[model samples]
Target: MAEIRLAIVGLGKIAHDQHLPAVAATPGISVAAVASRNATLDGVPCFLTIEALLASGVEVDAVALCTPPMGRHRLAAAALRAGKHVLLEKPPGASVAEIAPLEALARDRGLTLFATWHSRFAPAVEPARALLAEAEIRSVRVNWKEDVRHWHPGQEWIWQPGGLGVFDPGINALSIVTRILPRPLFVTEAVLEFPGNRATPIAASLRLGDAAGLEVAVEFDWRQTGPQSWDIHVDTADGALVLSGGGRHLSRDGAILHDAPEREYTEIYHRFVALIGAGASEVDLAPLVHVADAFMLGERRVVAEFHW
Candidate 1:
């Protein structure tokens, strides 16, 4: 197996908890360097900025970008222009428009540019998709709620314009929705609830539809106090299909169907390696495009001030 020399561009929580471990376990990937403003990995060469990393002659073959969506485009573009394969974390960029440019850059450079949707790689999602494909779907509902303070802590960036607030997790639900449904769905109505002191919404409610008259409703909240829920249920003619635990478990008719260890990031890394080897790009922006469309179309309601 050819080892792909990789650099991690963000040293944040997701990088620490998921990316690092997954990359360490992947067969054809190696972390050659990392770039961050104030974070570092043990024994890994660290640079203060991406430009510095590229200037250091690290001989990296690919770059994984886990930075906030706001500044991701420029970094990914630079990496592709430098003849390196690029892996972009979920919610690929701050705006859907930006991703197309990066896509073009990678195409022009003949490099791989993958928009990683780790949630779609959950073990049970494929089974759930199979189950749903056979059903006459009537309606769908998604409930993704968690405590913001517990998940994000003092991370103030999430509340900013491009931070995505509740939609950060909500898009994960959208990614699964797009993957499982037999048809494509588009947003019909949406309402975003923003804290008075914040630029992004703390919660959102969305109504989506497909050409086949399928209706789907989604609710995203970051204020759940206990027993956080990440569930998606589909009503069908045969039986009810449920994907719970953020796609980790699947159930139908109140019986467990599939359950397995979550190896989403690992699968993501493997896919990245395959894309690089094929000299192809896997760029799907439906999830992020819907997000930006929701933001553009949804009515905003200001609630109480949020502090963390």
Candidate 2:
């Protein structure tokens, strides 16, 4: 197949830091244009909005949406209607209800719609999955804490209604968990700590379990000071497995099982290409469902106000 001429929407931090570089590195993919209100790429046609890019007729075969979840549905629907393949960043939409119709629309139009969970592509994720496939899981624990000041800086939208706050990073951990576990896990109880002035939570503690009563604990916090941590520990009948560095490192019983450089976005593009070739759409809402469940069953506690 010819190179996929892709247009990138919402050229913000993730787009500049990961998407653009990944697209450049992946074969059979080319950056045809870019659409963003305040950002643009050098050497590519830039537009203020997706509608403007579609109207300008830049001839794009696909579009990657890096926009916030609030307005993602509208943009994705319009792209599908326009007959272009679509790739959505994690946490596909603000609400779980919005995803089903988009999947149906893409299927009806025979266009590829990839709801990408980039962290699931971590090098150690599959290895961990394979290891757990044989071992009987007794319990699970997830600790995903990071400093918002260091990662998000002055990105104010994160504290807004649809920003997802700490969940913006928490969902990555959930994605990996959903992928590695043999059975589905559901949120049984949750506590979300919201800043007094913010619409979203700054920290959350969750209790989850599977059908067989297997226990799982998850903690997400944005108040870490010194060293940021993204780790998942799984205890099994055989031994304990640890996935540290946000799924980049996997160890068990004091021995390193898998550790390698991160190329998650690069692998994401590869999957997008394959999905487009197969004329299929991959949209798994399990991870997002877990988030929605947490919000529904969680108790809200107002914490001290935060300011950047």
State the lDDT of candidate 2 residue by residue for 56-109, as single tens digits: 978999999999899999999999999999999988998999999999999999
Q: Where does model 1 exceed 4 Å of error?
A: none
TM-score of each: 0.98, 0.99
Q: Which stretches of candidate 2 lie over 4 Å from their true place?
A: none
Model 1 alpha-carbon miss at residue 49, Å: 0.8
For all candidates in order, the CA lDDT equals 0.92, 0.95
Global Cα lDDT for candidate 1: 0.92
Model 2 residue 86 CA deviation (Å) reads: 0.2
Deviation (Å) of 250 in candidate 2 = 0.6
Cand. 1 TM to true fold:
0.98
Against the true structure, what is every candidate's RMSD?
A: 0.9, 0.7
